[model samples]
Structure formats: structure tokens, C-alpha cells
Target: MKTIKSNFNAQGLVRIDSDDLKLEIKFESSQIYLNVISVNPRNLKTFFNLSDLRKLVIDVADKLAFWKFDLTVTWEGDELAYLGQHANPNILQKFIVAKNVEIKNLKGFAKLLGGRST
Candidate 1:
């Protein structure tokens, strides 16, 4: 397993990579946590809102029978944060792109999760 970590400011963006799947989350407002998931990495389009992302993840967990985990998203002041403890890359990618939004920078965008600049 691989790990990625970075600090995010208000409305800041942070991404994580596990195998072929990528996770992109943007800090929308300090009042609430917001994230936009995408498949193929480059689209950076948001298909699932917080509730949507949770439901989809639950459905996938039930279908795949992978280890059950909880995802907590929070934003306080100038901080945007996310915690996803999962093991299914396929499900993750699927959930991210489930809504079918167009990605802007395929290669460039996914890279942002690990080491690309916004």
C-alpha cells in the first residue's frame, strides 16, 4: 500500500493515489465538506456530492465485500480534509466517475493528486 499527505487551505485541493485509482477532493466551504470524484483522473469533474459519494461507496462495499470502512470529510477555517480507508481501486474509480463528467486534464489532473501543481 502507498500513502500520500499534504496540507490544504480553505478551498484547497488534495488528492491521494492507491494503485491505479485516484482521489480528488476540493475544500468548498468551511461550513461544509465537499468533494468531486472523477475516473481516469484527468476530468476532475464532480459526479458525487458528499451524500452521493457515501452512498456509492456503501453500495460498492456491499457488492464487492471488501473491508468496511468509514469516510470522514471536514473543513474548519482554512482547512479542508478527507479520510478514506478503502482497498478497492475499481470501486473507487467507478464511484468517482459514476456521474460521467468530462475531465479537463487526464494525465495532468491525476498527477495533481500525487505531485502535480494546480
Candidate 2:
């Protein structure tokens, strides 16, 4: 797995992008929900909001530790049944690291995550 970029925005939005997927998390005030999910497979674009956004990420990272796992994410190449969210980070626009997952890098950005950076 590879680490692309992890960033935090002014409005308190934290975005994490891997070769296979780009996830934007909005777990701050006003919108206490994880609304955006983009995976490697173009077909999975319509399959966002799978579960707890944080848990989903943590799961994906956890799966990376295993070389041979049954569930493979499109970004994974995707995996995350989502056990649950973190127990902390209840503050506004605060991003706490629950777990870190290393995503394998793809050849190109547009083809990897199916979206190119602007």
C-alpha cells in the first residue's frame, strides 16, 4: 500500500487520498456525517456511505497488514465493513488518527482513484 497525501482544510475538513481511493471526511460541526467516498473501481463511485467513515478507513488500513485477505477494495485495489467509529474526536473540525492504512499506488492518478487532482 502507498501513502498519497493527507491534508486538512480551513473549514476543518480532513481529506485522505490513496492511489486507489480519495476520501473526504466532514466530521465537524453542522454536518456530523461522512458524506463522500470514492474508491478505485469506477463502478464503486455510486457505493459511498458504506458505514462509519472513520471506521471504514481504519478497516482498510488494517486489511493492508495482511498480504492475502479475502476482501479486496477497488482502492484496496476496497475493504471495510466498518466495525464502528473512533471513541474520541468529538471536538469541532478536529481530526484524530484512529488508524492508518497504506494504500498501494497505481500507475496514474486519473486511472488510480478514477479522479485527477485539479
TM-score against native, each model: 0.22, 0.25
Q: List the residue pairs that clash in candidate 1.
A: 42-105, 42-106, 43-103, 43-104
- For model 1, how does the per-residue alpha-carbon lDDT over 14-112 read when each residue is reduced to its tens digit? 786754444555554322233334334333225435466556645644432222222333222222222233332345455664322223334443343
lDDT of 2 by residue, 58-107 (tens): 66544433322222223332322221222222333134433333222223
Residue 99 miss distance in model 1 (angstroms): 25
